[model samples]
Structures are given as structure tokens and as C-alpha cells.
Target: AQSVAQPEDQVNVAEGNPLTVKCTYSVSGNPYLFWYVQYPNRGLQFLLKYITGDNLVKGSYGFEAEFNKSQTSFHLKKPSALVSDSALYFCAVRDKNAGNYQLIWGAGTKLIIKP
Candidate 1:
């Protein structure tokens, strides 16, 4: 069984400041982690993924995340935030144990950027 956790229901940040959205996971073996963002009334847009390779991965819209094996964390980050960046972010994990390819998703984190 695999699972994802996004502790914060919302994150508040001032425009131009750095923002971070935390995520953690639990899986039997190595996990395939992903990040997605959803606007007001749109579908989940693929942000980035950690299939393998370097721990730090860069994704769409200046977003990046660091994969920590020991801590089992993949926290999303952006050096500079923008008002347009406000949206609902999600962290998901593909459980290899499951016969079907279904993503175990986190509850969600609503990011609010203040100008």
C-alpha cells in the first residue's frame, strides 16, 4: 500500500517571496512521485516527476522539488512567487504494488498568494 500526505490545507505567501508546499509518501519500494497544479476550474496539470536521477527536479512554472529518501519527503518549492501561482497543488504517488496504475493522491494544498 502507498499513500501521500499534504499536512497543510493552505499556504499563504506574499508576492515575490519564496513558497513551499510540503508532501510526504509511504511506499513498499522506490516510488514514482509527481506534482500537479489545478487552477480555478481546470484539470490537474503535470508539474514535474521523480522517476529517477538527481534528488532535485525542476518542473513547469519555476517549480522544483527535492526528493529525500531518508525523510520520505518531496517538498515543492519556488524561489520567487507570483500571484498567478495561486492554485490547488497536489502530490501523488504511483504504487507499484497495485495491479492497476492508479495514483494515490494527497488531500490537496490550496496556495494563496497575496500581493
Candidate 2:
């Protein structure tokens, strides 16, 4: 089975500073990692994903993630975050049991960006 986990319940970062949200995975083979951000009263918004290719991938809203095979980590990052960037973030990976490679999301981590 494939799975993903967000180890932190919340992450705090000051505006303009870099921020990272941690994610770890447990999978049999090459894992597909996806990151999403959810604003209050809004659905999730796709950020970026690591399917295959370069280890560092850039995505929407100036967000990016680095895939580390040895560490089994795909952490989301941004060089500088804004106050509006504060939201609930989720990490997901492919579900092996599903025929169509549906994603199973981990618990969300609240991001707090202080001005």
C-alpha cells in the first residue's frame, strides 16, 4: 500500500521568509507526490507534484517541492511566503489498491504566516 504523512500539525513562518511543510511517504516503488492548499471555506488547490523527472519541481503560487529518495521526503517550499499564503496544506500519494491510481491524502497541516 502507498501512503503519505504530514508530521506537523501546524507551521509558522514570518512573511517574506522561506517556509517548508514536511511530508514523508511509504510506498513500494516510485511514488507520486502531490501538494495542495485549502483556504477557509474553499476547496483544495493543486500546488505541485513529483511524478518523475527532476528532484525539484515548481508549481502554482510560487510553491515548489523537493523529492528526496533517500530520506523519503517531499517537502513543500517557497522562497518567500505572504500573509495570504497562510492556509491548510495537504500531501497525497497514489493508492495502490485503487485501479486508477487515485490519491490518498494525509492529514492537513495549518500554515500560519505572520506579517
Candidate 3:
């Protein structure tokens, strides 16, 4: 079984400052991790993925994440925060051992950027 954990319920950052949203996962084998963002009344939007390769992966809206296998962490990062970047962030993991292909979603973290 694979699972994702988002320890933070909310992350507050000032505009133009760097922001990060923490995530951790547990899996049997290698984990397939992903990050998504959701706005009010909108569906989750794909941000980035870590299937393999580089530890650092970049994604939409100037977001990037570091895939730390040893720590079982995939923390999302932004060089600079924006007021528009305030949204709900989710971390998800794919269970390779599961028969059905479904993502185990994390409890979302609300990112609040103050100007």
C-alpha cells in the first residue's frame, strides 16, 4: 500500500518570498509521486511528477520539487511566491502493488501568500 502525508494544513508566505509545501510518502517499492494545485471551485491541476531520473523536477507556474528518496519526501518549492499562487496543494502517490491504478491522495495544504 502507498500513502501520502501533508503535514501542513496551511502555509503562509509573503509575496516575492520563496515558498515550500511539505510532503512525504510511504510505499512498498519505488514510489510514483506527484503534486497538484486546486483553486476555488476548480479541479486539481497537474503540477509535476517524480517517476525517475533527476531529484529536482520542474513544473507549471514556476514550481519545482525535490525528490528525496532517503527521506521519502517530495517537497514542492517556488523561487518566489505570488498572491495568485495561493491555492490548495495536494501530494499524491501511485501504489504499484495495487491492482487498480489509483492515486492515494494527501489531505490538501492551503497556501496563503500575503502581499
Candidate 4:
């Protein structure tokens, strides 16, 4: 079974300092990994993804991620944090053979940024 684990229930960061949200995964084949951010009462917005190339993949809102194949991990990172960046983050992976490409999601990590 393909799955993702977000060990942290919440991450608190001060506005302007760099931040990170960790994630790990287990899957049968090459996994399609992704990071998504959700605001209150809103749908998830795509952050970044690791499909087939470079380990460090950058995405929207000055966010990025590193895909570690050996460790089966994909951890999201940002060089600097923002108060507006505070939200819920979810890590996901898609099983290539699972037909629907629907992502198996993590429990989400709540990010809190202090001003």
C-alpha cells in the first residue's frame, strides 16, 4: 500500500525565518509526490511535486522540496517564512498502478507563523 506520514501535528515559525515540514512515504513503484497547502474553509493549493527529475523541486509561494529516494522521503522547505504562509499542509503520493492517480494523503501539519 502507498502511504505518506507527516510526523508533526503542527509547526510554529516566526514570520521571516525559514521553515520546514517533513514527510515520509512508502510505495511499490516510483511515486509521484506532492505538497499542498490549504487555508481555512478552502481547497488545497498545489505547492510542489517530485515526479521524475531533480531532487530539489521548487514551487509556488517561495516553497520547495527535496526528494530523497533512499530514505523514501519528500520534505517541504522554504528559505523564508511568512505569517501569511500559516496554514495546513498535506503531503501526498500517487500509485502508478492504482488507476485513478488519486493521491493518498497524509494527516496534514498545521503551520503557525507568528508576527
Candidate 5:
């Protein structure tokens, strides 16, 4: 079975500080890891993906993630948070052998930025 857990319900940050939303996953085979962001009433937008090779992958909106295989974790990060950066985030994983290519998604973590 494949699954993902986002332990935090929400993350609160100042407008210009660093922020992180935790995520962990379990999968049968090599996993295709992804991070996505969603604005209210909008569909998720692809932030980044880790297929193979690099442990540290960078993506849109100045976000990056570190893939920790031993811990089965992939945590999202940013050098500086923005007020506009406040949004809902989801971590997803797909099995390499799964025929449908459907992504197993986390519930989501709401990021709140204070002015």
C-alpha cells in the first residue's frame, strides 16, 4: 500500500520568514514524489517533483524539498516566506509500477502568513 501523511494541520509564519510543512510517505516501490500548492477555489499547481538522483530538488515560487529515503520523508522548505505564499499545500506520491499513474495525496497543510 502507498500513503502519505502531513502531520501539521497548518503552519503559521511571518511575512518574510522561512517556513516548512512536513510530509512522510510509504510505498511498495520507488516513488515519484511531488509537491503542489492550491489557492482557494483553484486546482493544485505543480511545485516540484523528485523522480530520481538528487536528494534536494528545487521548484517554483522559490520552494525546495529534501528527499530523505531512509526516513521515508520529504519536507518542503523556503528561504523566505511571503504573504502571497500563504496557501494550502499537498504532498503526493505515485508508485512506479502502478498502472493508473494516479497520485496519492496528503490531506493538506494550510500556510498562514502574518503581515
Candidate 6:
């Protein structure tokens, strides 16, 4: 079975400070990891994906993630945090079952940035 975990329910940071949201996954063969941000009324916005190559993948909104295959982790990082960046983040992995591919998402992690 494939699973993803966002250990923290919330990540708090100050404006202009670096922010990170941790994520880890377990799956057989190669894994396809992804990060997404959720906003009210708006659907999940694609951030970045780690399919192959580059251990470090950069995404929208000045966000990037480090993919560590040995550790089975893909942690999101932003150098400068902004108040407007506060939102619920999700980590997902693709799982292929019975010829169909589906995304297995994490519970979520709410990011809070204060001035």
C-alpha cells in the first residue's frame, strides 16, 4: 500500500522568515510526489511535482521542495514567508491500482505566517 504523511497539523512562521512543511511517503517501485495549496472556494492548486530527476524541485509562489528518496520524504520550503501565503497545504502521491492511477493525499497542514 502507498501512503503519505504530513506530521504537523500546523506550521507557524513569522513574515520574512523561512517556512517549511514536512511530508513523507511510502510506496513500492518509483513514487510520484506532489504538493498543493488549498484556498477557500478555490480547488487545489498544483504547486510542484517530483516525478524523476532533480532532487530539488521548485514550484509556484517561490516555493520549493526537497525530494529524498532514501528517507522517503518531500518537504516544502520557502525562503521568505508572507502573510498572504498562509493556507492549507497538502502532500500527495500517485498510486496505480487496477490500471487506474489515483492520488493519495495527506490530511493537510495549515501554515500560519504572522507579521
Q: Quick one: best lDDT, which candidate?
A: 1
lDDT of 6 by residue, 1-115 (tens): 7899999999999999999999999887678889999986678999999999999999999999999988999999999999999999999998544245888899999999999
Per-residue lDDT of candidate 1, residues 1-115 (tens digit): 6899999999999999999999999998778999999999999999999989999999999999999999999999999999999999999998677767889999999999999
lDDT score, candidate 6:
0.92
lDDT of 1: 0.96
lDDT of 4 at 45: 93
User: For model 1, what is the alpha-carbon lDDT of residue 2?
Assistant: 81
lDDT of each: 0.96, 0.92, 0.95, 0.94, 0.94, 0.92
lDDT of 3 by residue, 5-115 (tens): 999999999999999999999988778899999999999999999999999999999999999999999999999999999999999998677766788999999999999
Q: With candidate 1 superimposed using the best TM-score fit, by how many Å does residue 59's alpha carbon deviate from the native?
A: 0.4
Cα lDDT for residue 103, candidate 4:
87
Off by over 4 Å in 4: none
Would you give me the overall lDDT of model 3?
Answer: 0.95
- Candidate 6 deviant stretches above 4 angstroms: 96-99
Provide the lDDT at 108 for model 2: 92
How close is every model to the real structure, measured as TM-score? 0.96, 0.93, 0.96, 0.95, 0.95, 0.94
Segments of candidate 3 deviating more than 4 angstroms: none
Our tally of clashes for model 3 stands at: 0
> Which 10 consecutive residues of model 5 have the lowest summed lDDT?
94-103
lDDT of model 5, residue 115: 90
Backbone clash count, each prediction separately:
0, 0, 0, 0, 0, 0
